[model samples]
Target: MRCGLVLVALLTLPVAAGRADEADDAFAKKLGAIVRDPRQSLWARVEAANMIGKIGPNAGAAAGDLIAVIERLRPTEQEPLQEAIVEALGQLGAPAKAALPAFTRLAGRTIDLDLALKQSRDAILNSSDSQEIDALARQLLSRDPSSRVRATKALSDLGPVARNAAPFLAIALGDADADVRRGAINAINRVTPNAKPTEAFVRAIAVDLRDPDANYRLLAVRALGRLGAPASIAVADIDALRSDPDPDVRRAVVDALNRIPIPQLPPGVTATNP
Candidate 1:
């Protein structure tokens, strides 16, 4: 039995190592072809770019080539090609940090801010460095209103690393635009995983919960869940909702209660709301 186990391990190691090397080599070759083949279809180049992004930081050397391709294409030239570049840059992570200045410049140009925001968010999420994320978050915060909205959404996507934007996000929670407020609330929830709702915010959310828009109420419920048990406003409201005339509200209330941490409840507090 021992001998068989040893034999199996020995046989598997070299084969696994060989497969890894083969994959790496194949990726390198495909990357080279994508950069060098002018006659390649735009879709093929885009596909190769997507593959490089999936390959991660090891594809750093391909950054220059990818940037060259991006520069050659007009803003409206090829959407697939542009998306591929964004994904590849994201995959490159810290190695692609050098491209940020260029990206910043391009973002300031006549190009679509929405698309630029998407790319920037991708880069921020893929970045290995916290400093890089901080810098990008700051830039996004200060950009145009539309970009700020996108940045807030991206920061939410980055989760706790975006804690720096909490103050700004809180301010956004009161924005005149409902969309902006929603985005801010989302960012706040992301940064404060164990967040406790302030009485005011809780009250405001409760009012939103009764808004004519079902989606707004749904988001408010989700935010309440993220706030944990101290979100008494949500707990009380949801408990009442358990017997609500509307089936949807009752279901939402049940789901919300399931998310609260029972152990975190104050002393004497039962798992069941009174």
Candidate 2:
């Protein structure tokens, strides 16, 4: 009886596995049907696109169909469909790489391509894997105008893993476009917590501190603080900044000094006293 029971348990395993696979197939089929149905309203189609993205590469066979839909609907005056297509491409992940060349070619002919590329950047940046992030960053770096913006955004999204892109980011600091330069500086400040601000960057911020651009000065001060205590003593201008006319700049200096882990005072003198 024991032998018979063991034999029966082994026999049922394949059947159970098959049932699970069949269920997944049925679900995929249903989603495909919804996505393909012309009678569906634009909103419904957008919803279907979102569902497909959540399903991931399980819907690989449907990639061609989805690409076609994105191409056709991209030019439509409807915003919802365009949004849906962007979301769907993100869901497609690396599988969508095959479609990129075509997308790039199309991008050359129209302004809408910029929006689509931005959506792709958002999707890739939000992905969970470092490999995907790197791949997307490399692709974006190949484009003009978009390259600098996308790379900056990607570095921000990548957080610590973006250390590998340091060389490229360093070059971006001198970009002709001020926005790109600002973004690169912001990204570097974010990715390199231990980074000592370069002399050029320090001087740049110093100049901006007196500039009319309040936002520029604000970002510079914030970046300086994150450079931590090591940088404070290293920078020649730190003493001067302690007395900056801008209250915010002075506050930032104090905060930066505090970040440096100093030894306890020998006697009565306290951190606040200094």
Candidate 3:
């Protein structure tokens, strides 16, 4: 919520640069100052870098400055700062195209790092190619992790307007690549926070809940919790998971059960309070 860019606690937060609670001239100026100042604390710099993306295309004017900030930090594993800066470039879209070479140089570091760079680079270069939206959406199921990652971010960037892609994204929750799985989950949440969970969505989470990987079970439980009322469709299956051997999965199930509210009883029915 802080960046308005991410919702699933990805390395970088979500950006709202040109969307809700738009970032303005003065706000960008303040962040730019912090980003440019060598004396600033690392967290402050990270926050400033993120805000630039939240400022979206409005921060286009600061693209050079943001690039400078990246130049100052990218020589090593500057985790938080790298995420923030690349996320900022993603927000700026095509305006940050000048930094594509830098991103290209930065790719292949790690699955996460490479995906982040590719996402931002593509966002800045081809995200607006409307005709390709369908192709990208289908790509979410690609066996290639890179293709899946790109599709997830693209669909995510498209937001709720990407109604058509939601099912694919939901299915991606079970991807073997942890990064794709997480990115797909993030995209699904962002695209349908208030909508009923599609049957496909519920099925996808169900599959994850059965996964041998505890992480998938944990993520699926957390997803059911986030889906709230709509996720009640999986109540029986989720309830059965209460005894899951993994403590984390059990905790997640408890959290999910707490999240899905009970329906109202009939007037003739006697309801007892817990």
Candidate 4:
């Protein structure tokens, strides 16, 4: 009787798992049908997209079809659709890498979409596995822009772990996509805030400060400020640029310098208190 019971239990396991998969497939099919059907109200489509965002990176399988839904709508009508798709793609991480162009096209074109797009772009590259995140960071040099962006955004999301991604980010700093380059520089600064000014980690932002693009200069200055006193070593660099050609860049220089503290001496090298 024990053997009979064990056999029945084992047999039922596969059926249970299969039923779960079947239910998932049925749900996805129903969702796709609803999203693609014109008869579905805008609110219904919105709900479908919201469901995808809730699923996060687990929604990679539906990324393509979801993107298709966005493409079918006019750009003027894409804000709400963009919000849902952005959340879904961000959650899907590396799996939705192929749809980056679609995401990029919408970037910076609309005020509402821009903020979500900035935050959403990083979601496409996130992963629970540190190793997977590391590998994705190494793809910054991929000939495919989308693939490179995937790595860039993933590394950015990894924060301090991006210290391991410095080499790749250095490469990304030279990428043609202005967004990727800035993102890489931003990640390097966030991860290496306390790194000595002379460290190679600061090289990426150093390049950005001198970059002709004011946006790049502004980003570099913002990072320097975020570093506070540990980054005080750049005082000469910042002071020299206080009269920068761009008003925003100059303001950042002042703010960054002002934010640096006076008491951040190197470890084991204490300074006398005033």
Whole-model lDDT, model 2: 0.58
Instruction: Go through the candidates in order and give the clash count of each.
Output: 0, 0, 10, 5
Index of the highest-TM-score prediction: 3
Clashing pairs in 2: none
lDDT score for candidate 4 against the true structure: 0.64
Clashes of 2: 0
Residue 252 lDDT, candidate 3, scale 0-100: 83
Off by over 4 Å in 1: 1-96, 99-145, 194-204, 225-228, 234-246, 254-274
TM-score of each: 0.40, 0.40, 0.42, 0.41
Q: List the residue pairs that clash in candidate 3.
A: 4-14, 4-15, 5-14, 5-15, 6-13, 6-14, 17-54, 17-55, 17-56, 93-124
Best by lDDT: 3
The residue-by-residue lDDT of candidate 4 on 149-223, one tens digit each, is 777777767677667777677777777776676677666656665655443435455567778888878987887
- Residue pairs of candidate 4 with colliding backbone atoms: 57-91, 57-92, 90-123, 90-124, 93-124
Error of 1 at 130 (Å): 6.9
Worst 10 residues of 1 by lDDT: 8-17
Tell me the tens digit of each residue's lDDT in model 2 across 2-117.
43343233334322323455554555445545555566665566666676677665554555666666566545445565556566666766655555544554454345656776
Worst 10 residues of 2 by lDDT: 7-16
lDDT of 1 by residue, 1-274 (tens): 4433432333243223235655655554556456445676665666667666766666566777777766666666676676667667766777667666556544543455447546655674557546555664664556366766787788788888777767767666666656666677667768877766666556556656766676666666766776666566556555555665656766776777887654444565445732
- 17-54: candidate 3 lDDT, tens digit per residue: 35443445545555666776767666777877877787
lDDT at residue 38 of model 3 (Cα atoms)? 68
